[model samples]
Target: MPPQPSRRTFLQLTGVSAASVALGVSAPASADATPARPIPDGAFALGVASGDPRPDGFVLWTRLAPTPLATDGHGGMPSADVPVQYEVAEDSGFRRVVRRGLAIATPDLAHAVHPEVRGLQPGREYFYRFRVGNQLSPTGRTKTLPATGDSFSFATASCQAWYHGYFPAHRDIARRTPDAVFFLGDYIYEYGINAGDNLWREGVTVGPEHAVEIETLEQYRLRYGLFKSDPDLQAAHAAAPWFLVWDDHEVQNNYGAANSLYGVPPELFVHRRAVAYRAYYENLPFALDSLPDGPDGRIYRRYDVGSLARVHLLDTRQYRDPLPVDEADRLSEQRTIMGAEQERWLYDGLRGSRTPWNLVAGGVVLTAITDDRTEQWDGYPANRRRVLEAMGDAGTAVMLTGDIHRHVASELKLDFADPASRTVGVELVCSSIGSNGDGVDTDQYAKDWLQHPYVKLYNARRGYVHTTLTRSELTAEFVTFPYIQADANAQPNVVARFRTPAVDPRLEAL
Candidate 1:
């Protein structure tokens, strides 16, 4: 990589003419030619991505990480702000540039930039790239949602641990080229590397640098950098815009609100959560509205995919009560997974939505299970009932979930124990990207889950759920990979498939 430039040198070299002018930035000269100085070798090593698609446009993101795994967590960038230029073109070749802008990659935010691009045509595919002097970031393709439409395709994935295995599932997701990806959390694991309790993959171990649990801001930032360094993950991000929600592993296992699983005091856990939340915002393609306010960030929101589907992206971890330890506690009416405010918001959205399909995207499973899985909706019975009742006879609802590390297709019922209760919707739980290493086809755990008739399918594997939503019906394919621990060339296979007709909410095997 080229030597780090001085603050003055960077400003002088990047703050030049036409591009700055287009973005309304006052600069010295026209930037029609390359910089007089040498460009850095890996300035855009982390790659480019876009997300949160609107009818007009979406957010474009990139970080200047020439040295991605630096210990200081600055991505090997200088302390000064770097002016990065971006362009949106109708073609990948940039021959028909439409929008050009400049954004400052600030050091305080770990040299990341999120430019809220707007005024583009709806339902149109656009190619975007970032530039710093003569250096160019990887080109990324993103599309804006249409104002009205009949069909849309999206994939749901979650629980990608860097130490667990290779990200063959992400590569497969890129190849599928979905319109959007719903990443339902555990985006990063918080456990210390090589802890011996969890051995990641067979014969493969985590590096020494990550051998300690991440607690501080720098540590968390570095952890995210390490995961983002994976080329497969980068390819997926580059392929389609992502809608993300973080589960427990983003901070610590089974952490609820300010409560820690290790019995850490609430006061201290809040500080840790603050750091994790800030780092999460800095790394992902979230808009400024999702920026962290101390330990809290507004992640629960809604997206309209034309007239086809209404996606409610929820945050179930930030304001929920801790997991119940006993049956009495689990059945408590006061116990909540989605806090009161979020619950109201979701209920109101479901009651008033006019879209053909109502899709609720969440971090944990919503379907009723036979086991006492208090960490999931099984523990928050009252809240789950409220949601089901809110959906009432709407019958158009579907829940997309992750975090169980297994693929499941289940019926959402007012009561799982009683077959006479009304069925409100269907829940599709996607398997992990690569969390539990190479999973088996059928395990004792899978058979154990089959005790509940609501669970139509259960598979222990590493992959994602691909779904196609149309005006007539919704089809879901449980895409899985045989191995991920060592097989980079692993291909995804459809282990099972199901479909739900427009007015019928039952998940029937296809």
Candidate 2:
């Protein structure tokens, strides 16, 4: 066995050490840092991805997985770390190279690399790719936002389940190729994959061993490997930079800082959650600074699209309290959806922004789902009030959300009980990419959401929401499709479109 590491070194290795501590340990320099000759076949199976875009640069991602489905969860890589080379160019043809760098693919991280490339032109398109020895990965396209601009566009998506059918939404989003994609959680479900689950993809069978719920690090890594292997999902990742966050399904069904809904002890579940988070960090192209230490990690962040809009991403799951069970608990001022520090970060970040448009993006629907207020913002009214106050303190605001598997466009109010409550912002609840089968055009059960006068449209279907922002106004199209189960190349139809002026809190039908 390898020598046991010291407590300080272990803490540093797991990223639990002090923020000032340098995590890297230097080794002797070599002429060629990475392997240049021996071939690792199909190392880029899960495909390349890029996200967390900025004015100067963005993050690039890839994994060396010659055998992606290896039960060991290391993606069939060498026990030693591998150095991967990356290239960024102004053109897809690679005639004008811009910036280049090397990122280490470590075994502990499932052989993945999240390289944050900087010092590029702002608001311009760039092409990037990865190379391990002579094997080059599939080329991906990404762009940086302008420091100040007149217009910007982006797509919002969430809740894609591998068991549910196919990703026509991702396929469509790739075709649209927005400036950036806000992926608001549930990227991969923790549920097991069975051979009978998706017969749509004939000859595709998951081992019976995978039919159990994923709770271990290996299970979570294998789950992501199966999900990321989708070609449609891969195309969407390659299409544009994605600003990503997570919801409950990323870990378990309805878990928080408290004991799980499944009744697992918090002491035990935290270990499972830690490994789940580590797997999540390794799979996606999020910033490395948000790395998890034990059960603690930071996913709440802010992004800007020039001077036109500022997007505030929240972590509604990590610090959220358990689902309220009684009236007092439901209305308790002590209750919180975004825990203290995250709440403070969110409020200050939103209130202090100078951009004309400020957006709050999160996993759960910001508005009330119905009379019940358990898992969503409604469960923590005081927290919602404070967030609304922040939104009102800032100028015109829009809250983008996912996870209810339905689309909703409504006006957010500080007081849901008072009919005269002033509308402070606009809320858009996007449907899942493909979580609940092919879905439908309308559902009678979803009508309760439309009971509120402020609520404009509610639809139960499978697709995403596309929005475009100008200096004066923002237009959103509620795109849905009737069939993804029957056909993989299903087309999208915009059932509802709304336009709201930068100064208006109302969602006007288009």
Candidate 3:
């Protein structure tokens, strides 16, 4: 007879099973030294990271993985002060140190810190690292935007399920070495997918022997740590500072504030959201103002890419009412995705912005696609129309979106049905980094939809979008990998290239 599973073994089997499924391995023995390591009693684990950099500053983040590395949120690590030192320099070496400071990693925030490093030269490349006593975390390199009027390049990506596939795209993004990376959402999936079973029999296994059920702060931390364990993600963070936002999987599926589509109870959803938000704030390099408070939280903020672009990061999840099932049209307008305040904030930013390109860093697709039952902009038609109208009137705007899980370059027309109206702005939708769904295919139905003059390039491929912007023009390219699970040395295929005039918004193939 097979040996009976112990309580510890049972917990490991279910809680992290999805992670194991991703790795394509059976649950390994607990005695494996490769999966477990011991840091010095006072040492911080999980290394360090930086995010959301402006011309003058960036947010640095790190956490103290609980002493025993508990997965159930009950490690009982007390609130303690961990002194963290941050350094920035022009050279990778310390010879020409420009900025240095100390900040306390407070227990109130699970021993995480986000030190906003300021007073640095703009548009120049710099290196930074965090230190605790003699132990040094990974050194990260970043660049601040040149003063407004300077032209530069940036990249955006989303939907990186660590277990779903490899992150060779990060390696590719690293090679291009853009000024910054915009991470839209789905940073982590909360559910446990089949590990090396059914569709993914060849995937490599990682952790949580079974599906994840807990939504506590500790659970979220473990998930983030698992993703950070990927060297590609680590290298991506090290390559450049990132502007980020979250989508459903970070908390639960199709979560809309008071509830989620997966049938989580209202109060239970609130608790899970609280835990997820707190964990997200702790793990990410966000400003202190974006911190969460138990259930109700704020993550919507904006980043200025100097005079080249003004990025307005909006929170589409936090304020949304529960999704409507049958009466989609009523909820389309009655339901508030960004709520009143955030919508107003976005509108104000777009209307008042003077940047050549107004990049709206949104979590969901802004353009409407047919038959997409998921919570896309189509489900919120009124909201979509309002946003498109705003972009049309604003004159210079571009929509960058995730949640579609496929690469598409579409012309934002006055209407999808009516092909005659002058195109308002160019909307570029990027495919997932590693999602469960297939890539966007240019099928007959897809081509039929693109019949509208505004609809330009439609592709179904697993890859990322690269946007190169300058004072003269803006170009968007859908860089596709040969396969989602390809090895580290995979090359990206430029499946389709679309460009638009910065003065007038129109999609044209290069």
Indicate which candidate wins on lDDT: 1
lDDT of 1 by residue, 1-510 (tens): 113334344234223222322222212344333333444579988888899998899998888888888887888876665677889999999999999877766666777778888899988889999888778899999889888967888899999987888898889988888888999999999878774666565555456778888987788889989888889999999998899998998888999988998998887777678778878878888887786666767999998888888889989998888888788888898889999999989988888788778889999988777547888888798898888888764537889999989999988877777887877778899999989889987788886678888889999999999999997789999999989887567888999999998776789898
lDDT of 2 at 263: 83
lDDT of 3 by residue, 1-510 (tens): 113334354334223222322121111233221211233543444656678787887777766553424554422344444566678889988779898766655445565668787888778888888766566777788888778745667777888876667777888887787888888899888866456541241345644532555476677776776666666777777888888899888898787766777776775666677768877877777876676545656778776777778788878888875555666553456656778888778878877777788888878877766545547666676666777777766646788887767776778877666777767778788778777533445555576446556667766666788888887688888887766554555678898887789876787888
Query: Which residue segments of model 1 deviate by more than 4 Å?
Result: 1-39, 195-207, 393-395
lDDT of each: 0.82, 0.81, 0.69
Candidate topping TM-score: 2
Candidate 2 error regions (>4 Å): 1-33, 36-39, 195-203
* Reference-based lDDT, residue 208, model 3: 55
Q: Select the stronger candidate by TM-score from 1 and 3.
A: 1
Cα lDDT, model 2, residue 370: 65
Worst 10 residues of 3 by lDDT: 18-27
Measured on C-alpha atoms, candidate 2 has an lDDT of 0.81
Question: Which pairs clash inside model 1?
Answer: none
Better of 1 and 3 by lDDT: 1
lDDT of 1 at 376: 88
